[model samples]
Target chain A: MMDGSMALPFWLDALIALLLLGGALVALLGSIGLARMPDFYMRLHGPTKASTLGVGATLLGSMIWFGVGHEGLSVQEILITVFLFATAPVSAHMMARAALHRRVACRERTHGEPWDEMDRLPGYAESSSSSDSQR
Target chain B: MTATVLPIALALFSLSLLLNLYRLLRGPDIIDRILGLDTLNVNAIAVIVLGGIYMDSSLIFEAALLIALMGFVGTVAMTKYLVRGDVIE
Candidate 1:
């Protein structure tokens, strides 16, 4: 299965290689930041941004590689790209809202709480019912 | 060069998955774990696409697309449940 794909020119191959390497490394860095960040809010920052850009770059490379081939521009991967860009922020927002609703612990340096923001949410209710606290 | 880099890229992505696993396992709170899971879903798409390229097959991208849709829905559902104590209300 590995053999028989058409050959790519030198510069194109190099570009694809660069994209793959850089994307992979950025993804790893983001996951590392996700694991090591001090607060749950802080932890949310890295992976959301990293995974989108990292995967976007990698998919761009894939698109270019397959686009130049015999099938003439494989258009399907763009669906994944658009889907990711559209959803990353939505999920990040949802997860952030979840954190605030639950009043997840934050480090001392975390500035003002979004307690007001949480309170203003349409269905916001205090975490009094959530008795399980790691806080 | 493409040949050399593909396996290295694959290895790097695998390592990234491991780090996401660490956060998923050890997060101090539920949101962090959910974040880990969300990030894990996003990164897994990249891995599948890369594998598709290496295998010279385009069939697996359907799986990647399925993953993207489900991941978003799952994240939203869990977060909604967390906030409102219900998924559908």
Candidate 2:
């Protein structure tokens, strides 16, 4: 089955290639940011946004490739894309909150974090450890 | 062109995965590790989808979607547990 974009037009194939390559590069940048960033909040920006966008672009490319070249409109790719778009920020927000609750260290320039955050949490105690939550 | 580009793209994503693994292993703190794991999940999904495209099979889309949902759920669950001592009340 020659359903790949090659069976389509050269221009269409180029577009697919661009999309996949851009997505991959963006994802690589995000992971580089993740591995190299100095602060937790700084690190938060990497995977949550850039990585999500990277994956989104790739999925979009695949969606078009499959939709046109292969089967007719594979909804699963779109579902994954939208679901990831919706969830990335939510998870990022929750992770930030968790980091704050656990009082994870921030970079020196980070501002607005309350030093007296011990009482900020409703159930701070009765837990295992902030460094690593109990599994 | 896609013949050449596909493998290149796959390699880039795998390198990204390696960076994420480095972060997960060498993260200074727990949140960083969690972030690493989350990024790993996202990249892994892309790799799976890319692999599907390479194989010219749409069947793996199901696996990609499943990973997407599970990744979100796992991230949320871990964050929730960290935010509060309990996952469910």
Candidate 3:
């Protein structure tokens, strides 16, 4: 079909490109963390913190596209950015705690006993102090 | 027109989503799956924004908002379950 619609300005297009590129890079990093990080506790830090930022960047890019090209403010993307920011951390915290609990349990089974926090705390402190002295 | 630009952005976003999917599938631990799932939700929201751009309709924005809401609540619920092993408690 023949076209009469106004062309998007160069700046607007550049903004969109920047958004996608940034978003993709964020995702790539999260995936890398998922692959490279060792153990559950260590791995938990990567995607929840870093990738949330990445998605926000990408969403902001999309918001620019919609706002400049289509109508007024892209409120939906704004809302999404807000929601993602709020929940990503909460979820990661829960999962990490669960993983930690599971790890603690797993260790107990292997050792044929559970560690009491009260009993272990002083021993842990003394050993830590001794190790620090040796260092 | 924005139409031409929309597709390229959508395609790139889709590729990101697929990459997240691959991570989800290959995750060696439960935390990886949770991370992958979070990425997927973020990508879904991105797609909704892209949809609005592609169609030049503000209506798609509502869908994006809903996705954002659902994704957050769902992630929170899943995380709670993982920790407490109970939805209410």
Candidate 4:
């Protein structure tokens, strides 16, 4: 395992190191944001944006590292990247919808009127009355 | 030289995972916890890939792929349940 390092040139090693470190740090920052953000809506932004990019970078690094040494391109790594890029936003949207339907409280600093006619939307019938009671 | 950098990457990823766990445990709302869980799975995939690199094996990549698939489905199901108050409907 260790002997593979000799096969890779120093600059390639540096590129991999940079990609791995950068991705990990961004991911750590996203998790930090998730932990630190005060409200659910604010917290949603963190992992959705930073973590997606983090994993994408890390996967790219893996692809490059494996591709250079292997017989051809690392197609599996590409599949993960594509899958993540497609799903991350969709999950974030669903989570946000769930939060809204549940009437999760938002921070005062949040500027938008998220509640305006929100209950009229599908799957939110029960929440409209509850929203009125909570106000 | 390449071997020396693997540990640092692993440590950073571990720290991120710990932060995600804290969010999962300390959530003031269910959505927050769900968000934590979603992030956790993504980070886990990254960690698995890094492990593959460290171990010099293509086999671990299969595990990473499976995780990515299952994690997305799980997140979507959980979020749908939260939104509609039911999974299938």
Candidate 5:
């Protein structure tokens, strides 16, 4: 039996609605950034950061909705939030390195412009132009 | 119980999925595309969770768990390959 007051149902619904709204807002911001960012590395910041949070909030909202609806406190919803925190960065790192291996170049448009410049590391060819643009 | 909320959440999640699709298509670089795929995976998890909510079934939670566990492994291995050219040292 749900221990909380009967009024809790209304509260829970309100909470879920707020969470969904927040998640949608975050998702929207990520999409905007995806379109607005100028370079690959800059673009990486959008979905990895914002979309992850967006999905997390949305899933968490769903989890709470169902858990409370069923009058159970199971935390199964946390699985995605935990997974996102773990996987998103690793994937981003991999993609960034792969792009580098392909000699993917960056645009010097963002605040942290150091990555755009070719490093003097051994065994890597320095390209004067962004790789994707060249293609 | 609020009957309409489930359908609304489903619709919103699908919209998010579409946004991720746009990234996959319009990415200027390969890594941007990979990032988009990662976003897609997370969005997929959200959809599964929301589906569980709508159906009042816990089975979807198990699938969500598997995705959570394996997705991390897949991403780590892929990232390792991208960085060192091999998943294992």
Candidate 6:
């Protein structure tokens, strides 16, 4: 079994510890925000922004730990990291769109017109109007 | 020292998982629930990775990879359904 003797150097171990701690802390905070935030959109901000970074840091720490301890470099953890980073924003955007389509209420302090009006703004295509009405 | 730290980190991650579970249960809207589930998926992946570290196994890394793939697909599919009122049309 692997033990402290098999661990990386002092500084490297410290860095790994810091990464794990920081990642978990950020992820915990994101989950806390999801639980505590006032509205759906506000809650959406937490996991998408913070948790992505948290998972990335944790994966980095894992890569470093395994790379140093094993015979060769470790690259598999990078797949999860890249997959998460690429997909997080996309999922967040889809969730926000879904929330808007469902007419989920936003906090009163939130400014500007609802998404329906902004649909006319540059990128949303005219064809989406049919789907908008279906909601 | 490194051996000791792993369990502490694991406990902290478990706490986060509980927090996510609370959000998932308490959601007043479907989208909110979906968001909670998505966050839960990500946190679960993190937990699995930490588990791999603790056990010093490469096998768990593949589990993490699978979770990442399946979770993203599930979230996207659910969101698409919500937006279009149909999964495939």
lDDT of each residue in A13-121, candidate 3, tens digit only: 6666777676756765765675566555555666677677767877777667656645667666677777778777777766765555444333222443333442366
| Docking class for candidate 4 | medium
Q: Which of the two, 4 or 6, has more DockQ?
A: 6
Q: Model 5, which residues run further than 4 Å from truth? A: A1-8, A69-71, A97-103, A108-113, A116-135
In model 5, what lDDT does residue A132 have?
A: 27
lDDT of 5 by residue, B1-89 (tens): 33455567667768777877888898876566666666777777877876766676666787877776776676667666665556775
Give the best candidate by lDDT: 4
Q: Write the per-residue lDDT of candidate 6 for residues A37-103, one digit (tens) a residue.
A: 9999889989998888888888888888888855334466888888999999999999998887777
Interface RMSD in Å per candidate, to 1 decimal? 3.1, 2.7, 6.0, 2.9, 4.8, 1.6
The full ranking of all candidates by lDDT, starting with the best, is: 4, 2, 1, 6, 5, 3
For residues A1-135, what per-residue lDDT tens digits would candidate 2 score against the true structure? Answer: 334554778888888889999999999999999989888878888888889989988988888788874766777888888888998889898888778777788777766663345555566543435534544
Question: Estimated TM-score per prediction?
Answer: 0.89, 0.88, 0.71, 0.89, 0.75, 0.91
**How well does candidate 1 score on lDDT at residue B57?**
71
Candidate 1 at residue A35, lDDT? 85
lDDT of 4 by residue, A26-125 (tens): 9988988998988888899889999998888888888878888753456678888899999999999889888887779988887875665675678667
| Model number with the top TM-score | 6
Tally clashes: model 6: 0
Put down candidate 5 lDDT per residue, A1-135, tens digits, no spaces: 223324446877778877876786787677667657777767778877887888778877766766664747456666556667776777776677676666566775546544444355543443423432453
Name the weakest run of 10 consecutive residues (lDDT summed) in model 1 chain A. Answer: A126-135
lDDT of 4 at B41: 95
Top candidate by DockQ: 6
TM-score, structure 6 vs. true: 0.91
Candidate 1, A1-135: lDDT as tens digits = 444343787898899889999999889888988988899888887898887889888998888767877345555688888999999999998898788878888888767775666666664343434423422
**Residue A124 of model 6, lDDT score:** 61
Q: What local lDDT does model 6 show for residue B57?
A: 75
Q: Please give, as one word, the docking class of candidate 6.
A: medium
